[model samples]
Target: MKHRFSRMGVRGRLLLAVLATVAVALIVMTVAFNYLLSVSFRSDADDRLRNLALDESSRISISNGRVTLPQPTGEIQEFGTQIWVFVSGATVSSPNVEPNLQAAAKSLDGQPAQYLDVPEQEVRLYGVPLYYEEERIGTIVSGLWMGSYNYNLRMTLLATGALALVLLLVLGFVGRWVLNAAFRPVSRMTAEAEAWSIADLDRRFEMGEPHDEVTQLASTLDGMLDRLAAGLRRERRFSAEVSHQLRTPLAKIKAEAELALRRERNPAYYQEALASVSQSADQMTRTVEALMAAAQEEGSLARGRASVWQVLEEASASVGVLAGENGVRVRVEPPLRSLYIGVERDIALQIIQPVVENACRFARSTVILGAGRNGKEVVFTVEDDGAGVTEEEKDRIFEPGVRGSAAEAAEAGGATSRGAGLGLSLARRLARAASGDVEVTAGRIGARFVVRLPTG
Candidate 1:
């Protein structure tokens, strides 16, 4: 499967990837640049040391199997300076005694001449083994301080460090700017996508460049939105037409039934006609209710301040007669403290009544209505002693028309599922309208539905 970044948001992942790339590049650059700078400085230092040793080559003498050096006193020492010269033979007395010259003389290793730089003082030492026609005489040693070359290397390193810091800062800012600019089209597309709603789906996303990926995405989304908007329009138009068309026939049927009942001599005929008329009226009422719920769901709620307790009381009172008829008792456990919040009264009432009535319909004996504080929100739970929904059905239980296959086996007695199968669907929409949600509780023994509403 392709890699899916399901955890982090798109913007976060993009920024993280960009920053990581920049960080890796910066580290590699710093290391490589530092190494190159160090090598260059070291090469200059070595060259200066060698040149100093070669320039002083003539200032050497040997006599009596011993080496000597010219005395250059009172010389002002520059930075990184060091001087060392020692005797090559056992004799120490000489015309000009070289400091630490014996150390360089011992480093010959069978060579005629050799040069070494002293680490402590940055000084160079040259050892020349004196030879006359393959006969060993003695060695002449000379030393020169290299303070200037050490200072050069130090200054170069300091400059390199400062330049590297400035470059990193400039590159960091530039990289961020370029990245944001490069992704501007994507950002705009996302914002516009978020703003699109069912009411405004006819509006299309403005494409920047047709060949670009972002533009292609915008074109595809616009086409999809067009199809969806057309489908919704067709659905709404059909629903309204059906409702309008059925109204006249339903009115005629009800009126004729009432007229016949008034004129009928037989009491049985009157009762049967009235029952048929009442059933038709109930079906008409249910159809209208479904349409109303669908229309309301199409638009966002006009929120206002209202009391949670008051809405709950109203819903309970409305469903009280239904619950009693089904032999289900409902007891509301009012909150101990006065609880209030902002919400639409009608929507809230619509949401709760259906849930309570449905619970009562299937309730074997008792239906409990309970409300309490849930942190910053208020929660209501409607539970019944009926056969609770199974785990599989729980997912689609809120879906319209979905019910327990055993719904016929329940206490509802052969009555069809309530109100166009919109009890749960409408309830959920209304709950969301109030910045709330409805959830079906999963358990082994009972039917339970929980509703959550924000306190503000």
Candidate 2:
């Protein structure tokens, strides 16, 4: 049942919900009205019967210790036609009055007012006592038949029920029509969304300004589409960049391999060619790995927010491990105020960790991490007290496969450079994905890498 209900469209559900509420209210009112009307009609009938009995009783005269009721004629004749009157030994019955009700009325002479049942009808009987001084002379008993009252009330209730049923049917259809009209905007949006394709990511609902719920919904869907378009574009750019960057290394590997295979050579010559091939493959691998991370953002930058200090702390811990292994000290300077950014902590760490680790890997003694709020951006700094970038190398330092001055220095000094120049490239792409960037400048003591991201 629940599943069937869930399967119903919004229009059907809305119509049913409204109709059901109105139907329940109508039923309650009908029942209560029937009760109130029935009570009033029966009471009126009882009063009419009692008044007739009183008039007849007043007309009677007592002479010489004998009671004489008026004859069933004149004004009494009309009244007697709708009531049952029993006075002493004389009795009068209404037309078609039940013998059972007459007998029940006689029995109620000394009792309180009560109802007597006859077949499918009822009679309300009221008894009055007549007395001479302290002695009881006679009893006046009267009753009104309730069959007509019951019939009229039953007909009224039946008509009320029929009217309610008609209203439910009418309103059910009308409500459905109204609801469908109201949701027409949503239907249009659904159709438009269904027609959308990945190839047409730029096509948007573009609901200009949010006014109502439907407009708000359209605007939200457009926002989601915007994110999807941005992500797809980013992925495409990353793929293109990866292909472009990997081509040279792949060509080098192919040329070297083909050249070495062209003729037989000594072991030392073959070993040199194999090492060159291995280096090219390693460079290509690094490029692919970095580009893949840049491509697979998972909508994290668009949907997440975290404290800037927390991200710095976590990034510092991650870089600290690599720093300790390299005999370099990592120091994080506390910010003056708590700052939050639009990027998630893990993603911020992803973007910052690479740059910080690169600094720690190249640092002579210590690397300092610091952060501060600058206008609408959260700026992060990673400074290494090591050989800084030369004026010529700073221009193309963030480019993929550029392996700048630090890598050059490490290579010249016979130290292992941890990356194939993709770390800074990946870091810059990550920062830009979050509406920020990574830039390098000559610090007072060493090289400084600055990352700026949107503040929350």
Candidate 3:
């Protein structure tokens, strides 16, 4: 039964529940009404029988223990009351009464005042005793036929039953209409939400402030869609950034391979080409690993702790080759106190290495890498003694494919700028994924990039 009920749609279940409650109430009301009506009919019959008996008793005359009844008067005849008088071992009754009822009245010959029923004759009888100066003379009995009352009561019962059924049907239709009207908005909203989720996640119900259940539901769904759309956007941006970052090294690797295959070169020349290919492969590996770590962080996967000092040392070492080629001295200034950050060792290295490499690319002579504690975060600052970033370019420099004046100047001066301007963007993105941020701060004589990560 429960399973079958559960299988019903929401509207069906609600309607069934409403109908059941109303049905119970209707049944109770019908029973109570009929019971009260029956009581009223019975009370009326009893009162009529009692009054008739009293009137007949007053007309009786008891002389020397003999009871006499007057001939039927106008009032008694018009009222159609049956009267019976029993005196001195004899019974006298009104004419035309059924034999069963006459016998019933005779049975009350010596009885005191009382009421009784003759069901077989549909009659109620009340008997009153007549006394003559403390001596019992006779008894007078009055009867009221209950045929008309019983017929009226039966008709009432039928009428009430029919009315109750009609009311039930009417309520069923009204209740069904009310439920449909109420659920219509919900159905439409649900359909719209499903369609939006599949095709247009940016679309929203745009209903104003929530003041009711329907509005509240719409608000909740809108919030969920917003989060989903943001996540999708982040995923797409990450893919594009990763592909862009890998292109430089991938092209370098391809160029080296093609050059090596183009000529029958000496062993030393081939070795140098293979070395270049190997370096590009290593760069590609680092780019992929860093992006994958950022992805894992965004997905809320498990993250490990790394020593701040160790990460700085690793970042400096990773870009040591670039710094040497560019005649830049990369210096790591150790913190006075031991510190750890809430990120994996490789992820921390990836986050800081890009900034250090960028500094090496544009540094005049010295690039300083340092770590310090900042409230609840570990802050790493990389400063390069080169053409400093203009105030207007600080934020734009971190945008993908957007380079600062320093890189464009180097390129215009016929100096090779190894960076494609994606490093800072990728670094900032990774830092944010780990609940941190990278920003370029105003420096005295160089561009100071700050990376902040949560403390372990």
Candidate 4:
């Protein structure tokens, strides 16, 4: 089965993308908000400076092209050197002159009305020529230092940046926690699967109530587990059936062979009878070996590193004699790469033999032994061009000693069949032991047995 644990999948990727987008947007908006706040504060300061200049400009009077100031108000006095200047053509009087104002004054002399912004001091200086009776006498200049405004702006930006950084960090932590919580079910499923073993095949994953994708996945896994448990039960019953069906014949052969030997009458008859007994014993031994291999497969103890394609080739080689006897040819499909995983060779060989033998028995022309993958699972298929099984018998074919009408008829007609109806049952049992399964395909053309195994 292909699970979500090894992959980040859609949900995790989407969560990460959303978090990144939110963080970027929050930072951009925070910076813009701080910048706008600084501009608003600066605008208010400029408005105050403009009003102060208007109020103080009227206090100064011009006489003989000279500027003079009356006693300034207490409110104006508090401003100290941070003052306003009134200048005429040859007279200039001020409560203040900045160390850098000499250049500013000369620059404003030729201009009747203008505003200049100085980069060095972060100030906006306005020089307006004052007039009485439409005759311009001198100019009035005002200085607005932007130091406090700049300081406030810088602080605001720094504070907003810090807050944004903190919030992003907090959000990252919260996101990680939320993601972990959201994936709790998946994590639980992983832990449970990891702890699960073949000895406790009946156990199943507990599903949650969310009924989302995770729940759906759990439900699917549960269904698979149910099938596996049921298959195991069927295999157990099949094993018992094989034992019952084969024991009586073996006992009869043993008794008859022993009696013929004891009588020691007709040397030729005795020799023939002894050979027949040996044949029976050999057949019985092979059957027992097959059964033992099947059991090992069912126990999942047959797992070792083996190539699937090589196994199929070996099975084909083993079935060659039987295929010839039944007038059947084995065809191996191309592009079968030798991929190896953990699986016992004996178990794999035993599982494939009976399937191939049965295919030869029913096949009219050819049997193809092939292997492929269905997603992450390895699939081995034995397909024959013969009379396909009927729908009614398809489900019962893998039950030990439960032969279908055609197979039974072949047995009754003295065809010297090798099977006592336990072949497929044994095959399925062994396949399951390797964490794999066997199933009859749904097609109507021929008999097909497919074995599915996990790659990991």
**Each model's lDDT:** 0.63, 0.74, 0.81, 0.69
Model 2, range 147-242, lDDT digits (tens) per residue?
A: 677789999999999988998899887888889888988888889888888899889887689998888988888898889898897776566566
lDDT of 3 by residue, 1-456 (tens): 999999999999999999999889988998999899989998988888878777777777667755567754332324557777777557654545656777888888898788888788677888878677887767878877787888898898899889989999999999999999888878888788667644485788877789888789889988988999888877867787677656556666666688788989999999998887787788778778867767765644226899999998878766655776689999999999999999887677768877888898888999999999999999999999999899999899999778999989888999886677778887887788788999998776799999999898
TM-score of each: 0.46, 0.56, 0.68, 0.50
What order do you get sorting by lDDT, best first? 3, 2, 4, 1
Give the Å error, residue 190, model 4. Answer: 1.5
- What C-alpha lDDT, on a 0 to 100 scale, does residue 375 get in candidate 4? 74
lDDT-better candidate, 1 vs 4: 4
- Runs in model 1 with CA error above 4 Å? 1-20, 48-117, 124-130, 134-144, 183-187, 190-194, 265-456
lDDT of 3 at 352: 86
Off by over 4 Å in 4: 1-23, 57-91, 109-122, 129-138, 227-244, 256-456
Model 4's alpha-carbon lDDT is 0.69
Q: Output the number of the TM-score-best candidate.
A: 3
Off by over 4 Å in 3: 1-4, 73-80, 111-114, 119-121, 203-238, 297-425, 432-456
Top lDDT: which candidate number? 3
